[model samples]
Target: MTFRAKQSVRRFILGTAALACACAGTLSAAAAPANLAYDKPAPTINPKLTALSKAMQPKVYKVSNRVYVAVGYGDANSTMVIGDDGLIIIDTTESLTSGRAVEAEFRKISKLPVKGIIYTHHHMDHLGGAAAFVQPQDAMSGKVTVISQADTMKLLASSETAKANPLFTRDIMTARFAYMFGAYLPKGPEGVVNNGTGPAMVAGPVGLVPPNKLVDDTLDVTIAGVRLHIVRTPGETDDAISVWMPDLKMLATGDLLMGETFPNLYTLRGAEIRNPITWYRSIDRVRAFPAEYLVLSHGRPALGRDKVASVLTNHRDAIQYVHDQAVRLMNKGYGPDELAAAISQLPPHLRDDPYLAQFYGSVSSSVRQLYASYFGWFEGDPTTLNLLPPKDRAQRNLALMGGEAHVVAEAQKALAARDYRWVADMLTDVIRVNPSNMNARKLKAQALRQLGYAEVNANARNWYLTSAQELEGAPLQIQNDWFRGVASPQARVAQFNAMPGRAIIGLFAPRLQAERTLDVHKTLAFVLSDSGDQAGIEIRRGIAEVYTQAPPSPDFTVSTTKAALARLAAGDTTLAHLIESNAATVQGDRQGAETFMSYFDPPLKDWSDLHFTTR
Candidate 1:
């Protein structure tokens, strides 16, 4: 069978399995009573809205008397708002197929047109259905108004880099399926929830329609006669926004307020460290609202003023608890590792709150993030300040641990003792020393699974499970159907030029041996046709690479639109294919062409064999 045919079959099977599991009472109901084993008390329900899906799916509910929120397997949450003129949506679930299934719920409510869309954040589960909402032009046109924070635009625009991270957003997509979706949350077997059910799917290169109106602090607008109070919050992303309706006393807190789980201070996908202080403050800002009902971008809604206040209070306190503890240690001059160990214990109040659980994010990782954000990677020790390369450090550590076997054995002991953090560390060394260590891989997977199951933070759980999945085998590939015909060629060139010089250096590192050094002094520029945004980058070593707007004749002139670049970055096609197809062109130095290819460091090709532990 063709790849597409096989994928279709896989998706069908997975969807069928999910439907069966959801119908079998394996998934918990979103509005189950608090006293019930799986049901948490419904937070204050918005008086303006009534819950639908009473006959369709027990876990699915609706608001605005038009919008439908479906709680699916993996704790996956989707929202459909039917506006007076049309429908305005928030999140789109994990896949187009799943998103359509969500849309069907909306159909059951009302068949209003989908007029506008808002991506709470950039996570795939939330924003994967751009194509499903409307045609590409419709999304880009002012009629649809695909709104998001400016930072979210930056993230979506740099889709290539986001996908390139070691822990790609694909992992986030699947992990959400296993952990948050209804299959495991209310009550299910401890480790039976698996995220790897569907074929690989990547969102199309999204046409980043910046919010026509940018709100630094807050912005109030009415959609379909319903007033939405949008507020900026730096939680999962530096540019995160939450929507509220004072009239309804309802708040749609994008990723900021998951039903039960601590937020991920340190995400697995590599990025700048997030500030716990800022996260707490953002939650505090939301709590100031007279919100009676709370709906998270993920998980179920909280109904009632008291319940909403309670969840918000716990969420704020949980973040503050971590921040306060980390700050206390930092004041004592404790390093990242020290702070991580020191703040492992949570105060009983914070620990007992279901909202503060570590289902996604962990205390240890958050502590490390606090240190990294405040003091960077440098520790006080000079020897550690300027560290050896990763591979060298792994080799040295392996030798010190009496070679690979001994290191693996120690890792196993750590795993048995439930020392997952330590097991992860030891396995890192073993994997570095010997990348193909199957035993190390298995141990790493086990450690990650333990971490995933224990996490209260949804993002953290996803990260751990994703890591474990990578260890076991290649993750299913996400089809890049979304980007196929939507990218702009000029935008691709601009994006390539705008990539951070440090990232470019890292990408090229594999091909750049220590013995060979090239000092190419030159500046390059590219002007995007679509947005008319011009970006110029200077190439220099040691000195910081500068970005500007005055166009310069680059050493090599490569011409390709942003759409083509998106396809290349998404692994839809190769750089060579673009050149051969006349979609992309390069001029100037032939040697420069070769040099550029050297810099494109392919990410770890195998996702499944990423062993988590040394043992």
Candidate 2:
């Protein structure tokens, strides 16, 4: 039952090699030189998307003598402050590979040993690439102190990235995210234009360095002779905080205000409902600071107090206006979908302001979220109280509206008439009932392509186009992902140490294949040699639960170091291998426990390049 490691994942839409060949023909202007088309059909031909792509290019902006902001490098930005002694790097980009590049860039500016690192929030974009800036050994030896809000890790454990059902969550978010960031599209005239926040998604590793110093509310710390007042500003996430430099007249606002775009009150990517009211207040709190220079986690820095204040105030008011109006409409009996349409168009005064652009976040999406937050899913309508599931509803609707072919025929008519929206809606039913309906699938793809071309928000455009490609055939999607390599034993141990015993067990429960565990009724005691910590995992029928205290007379006892256990859990080593290699020892019913351990699915359960929709 032990897992044999598979070859590396090879899912790539325009794999790095192919991209170089395609673009190398012409380095500048357009990807395609003359009228000689690129080998593949243009990913998109949207002029707006194409035009905007240039502005999103990554560049390091030098704010002043001490400050520099690296923008559009990856999904996020890395801000560097060269202090009197060593440098203080704030908010590392999403990946270690990217972070390493940013660090190299810093070396060019100043060969300053990193004295400290500050995490503004719990998002991966902010803190995932910590090791690139400073080594774990250095952090342990007290050479560098990683700093963040006290609740940073806790908030991360509950965030969208750390969801209990990650694959399903990705299904809900990936397609949408692709559009928003032009992920699936090639970088050229007719393809991916610009990611609203920045430019590209680069391949890299995810590394996390736990904060040695945690900030609660506000903390005054002088690192490398720079007096920074760390202030709490929980906007995007609960653990959000901002750095105020009294000497430099600068404020590092992490995702709080990402330059030119409407603040995302709620992302289409499923997350705990964000309170816009709290978001606005957080912005207001920052506005109270006499910041002459404003450096954000994403986009260019704003110099001068007047410019900084205007950007902050306008961004805040735009959010307030949208939230207040959405609530007002909800009070007058408006549902989320209805409110989305009703409250989307901002006032001319607000809309004309460039920062409030619907490039990244949209007014409609925010309004929808606002309505949902106040008045749950039910709109006081009994008809919607207990509805059949989508597939069931699709079956019922299909029966009433002829059959799959008939639905496809109608969709064809709609497509011919250029009723793309209607075609999209009607063909969805046809596809749902019969995913093999090539006619319907192609027609729907056509309709979706049109919709994707028309979308302004990066997410919607990417989602539509991604779906269109999926309908075309088996699209290039990751299956059995090999990009995210396993973490080192030391890193794994650090992560495991942070979680409570029960939560750690709950993490593994999702991967337990019920059928495989049906007859494996046993209580196993896991004794960690390194930490001297122990937990009892009781398997009842197909369900598994964990207890802090060890169960007396346990059926099996698995003795292993925390690091070895972490490896076993990660599928780097199996129970059989562990026992053979003497990395782990099982004292009771070794054979039975080995069988039971095999039943637990691999680390990435159901990992694949998913065709998101059921159809």
Candidate 3:
């Protein structure tokens, strides 16, 4: 090896060791304090949210003689169905680390080849660890069939990067996702106690293998002497599916019945509005199955026919109740906030039902989402159509309320009275008028912390506390560490190497710097020598357009294997090094290729600037 190559290997080894140490103690370390004043003992937590933690304790549940589930190892659960000659793996959790841990426990049960891997949906938590359960060549060659709904690939493509229209980019979605899952916050009473749906969002390599077998409505097949039926349920996600085993009398519900929490009709992280009507109808379909055991992608499995029926019934009823009531209030000329207020809690039976707890999805957020689904953002108010900008509105509101000082004083009084919600709202105006005003910011943070402590919903609690931390100028920039912890550098390189050449090229468009590219027009062609796949990017004034066809006359062309591309994308090796090593060869001007690359924005390594609050 060359001197530089040896040096590179040494640096990678050292970097990997350092990353291992950071991830090893991540769960136990406290988030650094941005302001010492805000750092105190664990705040008072709602007893219900605290109690939910017990259900997430790591354990392997033996549902029956034929089935076993591993929960609390990650954000979602994985189930193994024993067959005559092989096993059927369902929903492989969220990360490679979690999947491997579950696989170890399953090995203790019975070692069998995974004949089929079923993805309940396209959500990362359900299918991210696919590589752990089955080999890529096996899946590609149909030795092990990977299955999912027909729409799964389409949805997955959208989330692969920013959309063409760019209404909600992947960056924004990821930022909100980090907050919703409490990715950066410390794990404790004052911070993230539990992920309502599971123990926590485990950070490690996400190995997503696209499905080879597609299911449209329902498919009945026998694998390894085990009869199975895969049905499209379409509840939490558009492509959601469920598996049923007639012989075992077991039904594995994906997110259709998300454990004990009320269905997440609308997630705070944001997505296409989950129509409550469609959701409940989907639940009704799953309820039709005569199953003795109910296994879930999240939470514990229900044993016995009666218990299974009861959980399904309550879950569907909860969705229908929220949907119908929100529509009823909407017809009465109530807006989103009013609809939420009118039906903040479910009826006595549902509210009290252990299965219908708002530990994951709250009624208020669902109501607001339901309203938005039926009626767009207008809310039937003409004045709201041309409302003042946020800054202007805040400035005017502060003037009407005497000024920043007066509003802060009033918020202080409200805080003293323990009216946290009002204090948060009033202080928001003052802080908006003067984002640098530390007093208003501090007061708002205090109120938010109190409100977070009282929330029964884990998602809301995490959001509240995360926002409060941001408001206190906490060095939330450290959140990038959690992102890095998701996968080792080598693991990430492998993941990118496994991606399709076209998809890899697609990821570059969203990062195009429009201003920088306004006067620059260039074409860069990528030819994967190993796979014979050709893709190209055209810099058209300000937009980077990606296509899979070979360009007629490209300004620059790079001939390399996908693995070489992966090393460059994962920052494991430089393009210059790859070229020097003959891993990649350039046709046409190499300097032009470098200049073309500079037109795109660099990857964001630190996300502290993407603040949830105090913007």
Candidate 2 ranges beyond 4 A from true positions: 1-48, 82-86, 95-97, 103-116, 128-146, 153-191, 205-210, 478-502, 510-522, 541-543, 567-606
lDDT of 2 by residue, 196-227 (tens): 66554444455566677889899999999999
RMSD of each: 10.1, 7.4, 7.0
Cα lDDT of all candidates, in order? Answer: 0.56, 0.69, 0.77
Model 3 stretches astray by more than 4 angstroms: 1-43, 84-86, 104-116, 128-146, 150-168, 204-213, 477-483, 487-599
Give the number of the best model, judged by TM-score.
3
Q: lDDT for model 2, on a 0 to 1 scale?
A: 0.69
Q: List the candidates ranked by TM-score, beginning with the highest.
A: 3, 2, 1
Per-residue CA lDDT of model 1 for 1-615, tens digit only, reads 233322322332233223222221121222221111222112211111111111112246655454467654222466666666887777665444455555665666777777767777755556654455565467546666666765554454344325344323433333233333222222222322212211112222222223434555677777776677888987777667888877777788888865456676775544455677788789898989998778876556777889889989888887888888888889888998888778875688778765655555668888888788888888778997678988898888778879999988989899989899889877887887776888898898888778766553434544565556557654533212222111223222333333432232233333333233345555544333433434544455422243445346666654666445444543455656777898767666645654544443343333323333322
lDDT tens digits by residue: candidate 3, 349-437: 88888877898898999888877777778877689889999999989988998998899899999999999999999988887778899
- Considering TM-score, which of the candidate structures 2 and 3 is the better prediction for this target? 3
Question: Where does candidate 3 have its weakest 10-residue lDDT segment?
Answer: 29-38
> Each model's TM-score, in the order given?
0.66, 0.80, 0.81
